[model samples]
Structure formats: C-alpha cells, structure tokens
Target chain A: MATGLKIKTAAELRTNYLRREMFPTIFCDGCGLGNVLNYTLWAIDEVGLDLDRTVFVSGIGCSSRLPGYINADGLHATHGRALAFASGIRAANPDLTVIVFTGDGDGAGIGGNHLLHTIRRNMDVTVILVNNFTYGMTGGQSAPTTPDGGFSSTTPYGNIEHPLDICELAKALGAPYVARWPVVSPAQPVKSIAEGIRKRGFALIEMLTPCPTAYGRRNGLKEIEQIWRWYREHTVLLDEWEWVEQFGSPEEREALRGKLKIGVFQDTERETFEDRWAALVAREKL
Target chain B: MHTIQIDEGWCKGCALCVIYCPTRALQVAARFSPRGVHPPELVRPERCNGCRLCELLCPDFAITVTEEGRVHA
Candidate 1:
C-alpha cells in the first residue's frame, strides 16, 4: 500500500520478499529450488499477505534451505522436524501466518509420522514439500518419494520399493487443502498456493521439482529442460483420467500406465486446531 | 514500450525465460556474467508484447518486464 498505480516489477518484488544478501543461491545450475521459491513468492504477493506477520520454517534438506533465503522471520530447525517446530510456532502465536518448507526425504521418510498427525490435527499452517525424487542435497540418495525402478546412489540396482504418495495420504488423513504440481508449470501452482495460504486448516502443496545434478544425471533426464518436458509428457489431469477410466477403451486406459496424476486431491473446510484450543482455553478460564 | 531488466548477479542462466518467451525476444548473451554463466539478453525489445511469461517463468527472479507509462516511487 505504498503509492499510486505502482505495478511492482519482479526484481522489485524479489527485493521486497527475499533476503538480497543471500543472492547467488547455493543450488546447482539446473535445480528447481529457485522455481519453487519464485512461485511461492508470487503466491504470497497474489494473496497480499503481510510479510512481517508471516513465519517460514524448515528442517534439514535442500528444500529446507529455502526459508533462510526468504525475507521474513524463519526457523531452520533439526532434520525432519520442521512440522513439529512449525506447530509450536502456530500454537504459541495463533495470529501469525506460518509456512513450512520441507523436502521429500525430510518430510516423507524420517518425518512421516509427524506429517500424519499434523494433517489429522488440521493445524493452521502451510506446508510446501519439494519432492525431487532423490535426496539431492545428500548426493542422490534414494528417498521415499523416488519412483519405482528409479536409480539413485543407494538404488544403483534400481529402487525396488514403491514411492509414497504423500498427496493421497494427506487426503485420507483429512487435510483441509492438498495439491500437487510439478515445477514445470508456474501459473497453476501460484494460484493453488494462493488458495492454500488463504485456507484456514492444514494446507499441503507437494511440488515435483527437478534436481538435475543429482536425480536427473542418474536418471534418463540428462538436462534440466528434459525434466520439465518429462513432467509435461507424463502428467495427466485427475478429471481427464477419470473420464478415461469411465468411458475410454481398455487400450486407451492401458496407455496411461506410468502417467503421474496432478491436481487438487482435496479441499474442504474444517475447524482448525487453534480454534479448538482457544475454545478449550476459554471454557477452562485459566 | 516495455523494458526488460535482468539481474546479472542473481541469474544462473538456466534459459528457462529464453525458451518460454512468446515473442522470441530473449536470448542468452555470448558474454558471461560474473557467475561465469551466460545471462539472457533482450535481443529484440520491440518484439516483446508484455506477456510477462518470462517474468513469471524466471526461476531465479532475475528478470522484470516493466512499461514506460508506470511510475515507481
């Protein structure tokens, strides 16, 4: 709310939203962390959230390093404990806008238990999980989100285990808002994230980002552009898939064997944990 | 008329903006930046239609498309 007819430039927006001192990010040349951060900032701007009131939190991982680059108050917590730390911050100050950044390995592997309970509680917070398939920061280690038969440092023989579908799990756990989008497309993610930020209860946005140096180099995607193109080619909209399932021929349905589903898995209104806690506090009159 | 601004220090020269530009106005410069990567340059400023696609798709937040009419304090 500064002045008349001021259309903020991207550079201006970056200066206002990000820590300029932290420029020249440590992320590899083709890494998608920059895209994720860029989209998140765009969402924040679209929603007109007060930067001073917002709090960013993250645990250990390549994605976790994002909050430190943001301009707002941030907490760089222990490995796989970002959700726990974010919950504490929200509970202590319910008025603040709390957002947590986490990676696939940090959120779905060691932090899996916390993720379940947090969604079940329906805490008022926004969680952005950047799923790069492998633990990119740790040199291409296989993660819980790594696709079946995907190669990683630990999975040189090909990952035999099935990947964890965090979006489906969050939907079953009753998270108020949940969605997944690959970093190749920014417009959908920006809109979805803006909606998630405006929603009251637990909001989770899982982004499939490229880790060219680590994941892509090992996998078939040798270049960064190949990763984006792969996402574009592999992803199928949920509605389209449903139509294909109900009406399309067996051959047509069989054609979608390895395609990834992308869209808002769940979005429902619910009483948040903070509201319930406030009610109890009032009833007890302590 | 719109002018394209590129933050030389911040750009990693991913060419995402270059590839996504609708007007084909952006191209990676032959000269390297301080970061040793070739930064994208606005080769044909007149061809830019203010689509802001490059602005939105820039991974590093290095590019900004602004018009001549807008005033900033």
Candidate 2:
C-alpha cells in the first residue's frame, strides 16, 4: 500500500504471473491465502525475478496449492517433503531460483525434520510458510503453530501446548534470512518477501494468515475484519521488543507475552548448499 | 479523480473490500452472483483517493482502483 511505488496493473499481473484458467480460486471467503499470494507475486515483481528461471515447490496443504495457481514451473510434491524436493531441484540447477510454499502443518508439523535439515544445509531456496494455526485444508485440526489455548476442531476444549515459533527455529538453525509478518498489511510482507528472495541461502518468511472458514469460527473471529483487528492488536515489531528488552524494566518485557513479535529476525550472509556442492565436485575431480 | 472496478464474477462478497475502503466508496450489493454471494459495488467513485486498500485486501482480486480524469471538478 505504499504510495508512489510502481504498481502493476491487475490485467498484466494476471496475464504474466497467475494462471488465468484457475480464476476464482478455491480458498474460502475471507481467507488470507490470497493476501499471501499477492504479496509473493509483488515481491517477485519488485526483485525483478525471471519467472521462467524460477521454480515453485510445494507440499500438501491449502497454502501448498499456491504453486498450482501461479504460471510458473512448479512441483506439487508429496506430503511434508516440499523442502526435500526443492533441495534436489537446487542441487540439480543452482542458478534457478527455487521458492517453496508450505502451510503450518506441511512445514512445521510433519515436515519439521526436513525443514531443520534444509536450514542446516543452508539450501539455496526461499520458503514462504503460511501459519494459520490449524490444518485448514484438513478440517481445522490443531497444528504445530497453533497458539496455546487456541481452539481447533480437534481441540474442542482449547489447545494446551505452546506454539512453535518458526522464525526462532530457523534463526537457531542458522538460516541466512528469517522473517515473519501478519497478513493484515501487505506492505511489510511484500518487502520482506522480496528481500528473502534476494538472499543467497535459505530464507524463511512465516506469514500469520487467517483461515476464516476452518480456524476463525471456532476462535470467535467469524468476521475477517476481526482477524485483521486481532493482528493489529496482538502483534508487536521485533525491533521494538528488543529495544524494550534492552532499556525497559522486567514488567515491560512481561507485557510482551502472547504478542506476536514479527518482522525480520535475522539476515546474514553465508555460503549456500550449492556452493559447497560445487567445491566438493571440483575437489573430487582434482 | 479515481475510479473503482470490481469483477463481479470473481468476487465472493467477503466484504474486505467494502470494509477496508477508506472513503466508504465500495459496498456489498444486494444482487448475488452465480456463486450465490453478493458482490461489492463502487458506490461512490468521487470519494476514492486511489489508496488501493480494497485492491490489496481483497481476497478475490475483485477490486481495482485507478487514477482517472485529467481535470478536477
């Protein structure tokens, strides 16, 4: 929503980026997948990525369906193995940009081990993980990213376990870039995604999007605006939180509990998986 | 000047466009699409400042706001 920035025409974007035959997407009304996808395409446009050379990879989930809608070379990979598939693609062709779309269940739940290994290797891929706190494609089951006390179909009495912070996990695993953003606003996410795509090694962008049909109704957020309002109310920038942690009292830090600390958590340079592989190949040849 | 265009066939009437419109220029119309949901309509074109909030928030990619008119009223 930044003013004065060059905005692409809808017709042009649809013709160039989206698969027009797939119009009227299957996402439920008020769902945030559209927002996530829009920000992603905007990011690709901003970074001037060559779509012909970019490959999209995804696993089984609502968010994973993203690749099928875009007019690009993509693999609708198996369940919980998008990163595994993407790593193979990256190893085969280091020059092509590999982007992975995954949901909380697909990325953090069944695929958590693969995610860790992929980050540990510092694979040359950009991961866009949409965490809606529930298995939106599978009937509102509780997901690894579901907040404590969150209500899902499987957790009728409310969830007891704490949520997994994907950004913290990725940063701990030494990803080259990690960021998180709520889907309420597109400006920050669009910019962050663009930056992630430009990074050299593993880049993870966790998007807290709303699944109004699966997750919202049970959580008393039947309205999409309410979810947006909740994001505006319950989220804080990580930089601001860090500043407060450094300068403010313990009580001030305590107030941050349950508040989603979003924004770029880390961005550092590192040799990517392909670089290591190339060195190994040359040394072996010698 | 600004103009709002909505693809009624594409719109699912989630009303994110209607609710996010800064000037209240868009509203959910009573008529339903073949999809059975009422689509949002541009009710007040003159009030729009081309913010594109509706365009960005719209889950359906239904709304598009464009700068229009070369002269002021």
Candidate 3:
C-alpha cells in the first residue's frame, strides 16, 4: 500500500463486478492488461453501468484481444477499425455506452482517423488505448507510440520519428475527457477508468503498459521489474506536469524526452454526438 | 440451501476475504487447517449479508460461502 491510500471500504471500485471470466484470470504472470481490465470492470460496477446497454469494440492486436476476454457485449473488429465499429454501435443505439479498446499502433496509426473523427463528433465512447510502445503481438515492430530512440524490430537503429502524445491529440480534437495512466498504479487507474465509464461523452484513458517480451528484451531491460521501473520513473502524473504546462507546443511535444507525463488533459461538459444527432433527428422528423 | 468450498491448497492467507466480507461473518482464525491454510470461520451467521465480498477479495481464491435457508455471503 502506498503511504497514504485513505483506505476506504468501497474502493471506489466495486469488487463484485463480473465479466468474461471468474475472479481467477489466466493472463501471463506480470501482465499489466489484467490489472487494467480489473480496474475497468471495477469502474463499470461502481458507476452502475448497464452491461447489456454497453458495447465494447476491439481492434486487432494484443490490447484489442482484451474485449474477447471480457463477458461484456462486444465485437472483435478488424485491424484499426475498433473505433469505427464503436462509432457504428453508438450511432445505432444512442442510449448505449460504447467503449473501444485498441493498441497504441492500431489507435494512433491506422485507427488515427477513427479516433480523430470520433472525438470531433464527440461520440459517446470510452477509449482505453493501451500504449506498450511496441507491437508485442507481432514480433515487436516499432509502433507510432514507441518512444524515440527506443529499439523495436522496425527501429533497430532507434526510432527516428517521434511518438505521439495521445491525450494531447485527443484534447486537440475536442474529446470531452482525456487522460493517461500507468497500469501498475492499480487504484487510480481503476478510478480513472470508472470516470471514463461514467462519462456521457468521448473519453480516453491511455494506459502506458510494458511489453516485456518485446520492449523489455530489445531495450536490454529484459526483466519485467526493469520495465515496471521504467513505467514508474518515466511517466509522471499529469497533476505534477501542470506546473510545467508552459512547456506547450508541437515542438516541445516532439523534442521533450525522458519524462512521460500522464493525467487528464481535458474534461468539459460539451454536448455529445448522441445529443446532437437526436436533436437533429427530432427536428428532421426522420 | 447453500454450498461453498475453498480450495485450501491455493490460499495464501491474504486476509482480503476477511476484510471485504460485507457482513463480517468470515474471520481468519488463529488455528490453521491440516493443509496449513488459515481458513475463514463464520463467527456470526445472523448478520450475513450475502454480498460475496469475501469471494471477491480472496486473492488466493480461498473462500466460498454457502448457507441453508438464506443466501451465502
């Protein structure tokens, strides 16, 4: 337990929440996704979310495989289209809550358009984009999110291109809620995911997880502990970065290295796409 | 009316089950079972809430609740 947890009985996370499997999960030892999923489910239960009315859309990749592991009503879509699938789900049933799960590459790369438009449209969707910095599912190819100078199959010479700050990108595109978290910090992640699950508008919870099999081995931090250490040291909570908010600009975003800032970049009471569409339909009498 | 069992072999005695039990019916006793697992004992049956908190918090998968003429917690 951290020094001051303010240990409350309820956990702000309902532990009884059930999903795809029983309590015992079969994820690999030290797998961060399981912790993230546990937090996600706890959030769902805390918010009293209707599982029947909630739909999860997953794209092709290790992170995308998460939806299938959950019992929630969800669909495993093709590569980089989880957002599109989630969009369709939200479009068809405005009342339902749609959540999209995508890996870093699938989301920030090919699914980039889907993500941009989803936020622009302010669709009622919660996107939990897991950024492990490498393509763990397919033999460790470099990802759009891999830190610059990080080694990957495609980046043996070190990645020349910069990694995208997803929360900033989402905020720029009009997402009502945007935040990032490290998977190891279980409690806050759970609270953050719950916040996303309860929000009525577009929300992004970017979890910076580690791919020990890919990222760790290539970086010479082969052990899971080293990766965990990296996650802890490199990623600073958004609140801590607020004082340094003056360091804002595309140039700074691209040049700044070493410290990976995490937190909710933006949250507003903007009207969601569902509201606008419903109003439009009401007016058009369609 | 109820049936519950904990796989003693897997219990790590995390005490999460004892902490999460809404009714506080389950408590870790000083005596360990034959398998050396500190099993949960129901000290008070009347206050059982049947919320399954014990089941949720058992990190070691070591507790199950079953009751007769009432729902298990």
Candidate 4:
C-alpha cells in the first residue's frame, strides 16, 4: 500500500521474493511463465504479507514444476490433486494463504473435480492456472485447453475440439473471483492477482502461457518471442473492456487464438466454509 | 575522446556485460526498453577498463570496444 508505483531493478525484485539465497530457479530464457511467477512473488511481497504464512500446492505437469522453483512451502502432488492437497493445508492451518499453481491438464482435466468441489466449498485459496494450449510435460500431448486448430502429439490431424475456458468455468461454479491473463501482461496480471490473493473465498486466475519447447515445436513457433507476440495481440485488460466485451464464448476464444485477454472478471466477498464450519463446531456453541 | 558504442537494436538483453564487466561500469536499464527487454547502459565510464568482455560475450554481437588512443572507422 505504499504510494505511487515505480520500476525496480530485477536485483531489487529478487531480494525479498527470491530471499537472496534460497534458489536459483531453472527456467529457459524468454519463458513467460517464469516472468509471471516472478511478478506474482513480487506482488505478494508488495502487499507486505507474511511469507511464512503462505503455502503453495501444485500437480503433475511442466507448470507444476513451478511450485518447486518458488521459495514458498510447495507440495508437489499427483496429477490433478493439487487442489485437494492445498485444501488439506488450508483446513489444517487456517491462518495460511494457500495458493495452487497447476497446468491446464492437471487443473481442468484430471483435477477438475477437485477444482469444482474446492470452489463449491468456497474455502479461501487462490488458484493460478496456466493454459499453454497443450500438455508440455508428457511429450506435448493434447490438453483439454488446447485450441481447436492447434497442433499436439495426439492431435496431429489438428485438434478438432475447442479449448476449455477455466475462468469461465470458475465463474460458472460461483467462484468469488475469476480472472484471465496472458504471461506477457505482467503488470496488470500481477495487480489483478494481488486482488485475488486479498479476496476471501474461492479465487482463480488463468494465465495463457507459452510452451516454447514442446507446443512451440508442434505449432511451428520456434522463438519464444513469436509466441509472446501472439499474447500481445490477442489479450486485453479488464479496464479495456472495449477490446474484449465484444469477444465472448469458446468460439470467441478462438478469436484470441493468436491473442489473450487479461482482467479480473469476478470479485465478491463471501463467508469462507472453513470459518463457518469452525464456528459451527465450536464447543462454546454446543 | 574515443568510446565504445553499443548497438541497442542488435543487443539481446543478456547479462554478459553486467556480469563480465571487469570495471563494473555497466548495468542493465530498469525501464521497459523499445525491444521489449532490458537494455544495457554505460553506468560508470570511469570504471571501464576497456577490456571488452561486453564485446566478446554479446550474444547478438551488439557491442564494440574502441581504444581511446586510436581513431578508426
């Protein structure tokens, strides 16, 4: 909450969020996912939140590797069970701010149930999902989020099915907050995710990242810069609704095939299930 | 009066100069650059030994080391 914003040296950014020593994360150059993670960590420190009170959970996928790269308390779990693990952490330590980072396949496909029930319960935890248009870890197989026309190992004939919009699903599931951002839109995404972290109840932020190594090969995008250009043209900001209000739906999402839209789509305050359950089961009340 | 010139357009935004700089005269710019990456700038000319690690390590061949005592095209 300190006043006006200003650009900082990457060195300065590393001091708090990176802790000056814990890890030197291994991520390739020009990878937007790492940049987004760095920005997210910086935003966390910007809010002056107690880092020790934070916990991170992730599932199997290339993006799942993120939780391990971060300085937070990370639990690398099985495919699609990140939400379940995070929920357990939250249920055990209600004071901690739980964050879950997973890939499109892990969160939306295998873990979709955990995602839904986690939101249905509405216990406070922030969800950060990356839709890189395909599964990156297991040799670039087709993911539930892969675009209809995009290429994947299993979709060599060109994916005929449309991609799933995780943000839309979260909103439909009655999540208190839902946002969608691209990896390149660091500033706005960082700010919106900050809001999501401060929010109570369920919050989900979907980021469209570039899998420069795997999906990039299938899509014929050799340079990370090329994929980044895709994000720059297609994505729009929340304040710039004019850029996206006209573009809606999964088919409309294709209009963003070469682009992205970043914003906080939903935000509402609600009673956390954990708090309510605790109060209800208190011995004093009985 | 001769000084090295860094071709910003060819610069790849790598840290070779920042890390290999013997005199600690260089630092990466903090602002968003035109190439959409952090560009290097000569922060302390006094510290430059003109050893040219920046010239050698430039991934894009963006930097050139020029001798102050020589005049050449």
The DockQ leader among the candidates is 1
Chain A TM-scores of all predicted models:
0.95, 0.95, 0.87, 0.87
Cα lDDT computed for each candidate against the true fold: 0.87, 0.87, 0.72, 0.72
> Which residue pairs in candidate 3 collide?
A20-A71, A238-A262
Candidate number that wins on DockQ, 1 or 3: 1
DockQ of each: 0.61, 0.46, 0.06, 0.05
Give the local distance difference test score of model 1. 0.87
lDDT of 3 by residue, B1-73 (tens): 3334565554555454565466666678798876676766677767776555564444333456555654333
Model 2 segments more than 4 A misplaced: A1-4, A248-254, B69-73
Model 1 regions more than 4 Å off = A1-8, B68-73
Stretches of model 4 off by over 4 angstroms after superposition: A1-8, A19-24, A238-260, A282-286, B1-73
lDDT of 2 at B38: 87
By TM-score, the better pick of 2 and 4 is 2
DockQ: the better of candidates 2 and 3: 2
**Model 4: CAPRI class:** incorrect
How much DockQ does model 3 earn? Answer: 0.06
Candidate 3 residue spans exceeding 4 A from truth: A1-27, A244-256, B1-73
Pairs of residues at least 3 apart in sequence or in different chains that clash in candidate 4:
A234-A259, A234-A260, A235-A260, A235-A261, A236-A261
Across A54-109, the per-residue lDDT of candidate 1 in tens digits comes to 99999998999999899899999988999999999988998899999999999889
TM-score of each: 0.94, 0.94, 0.73, 0.74
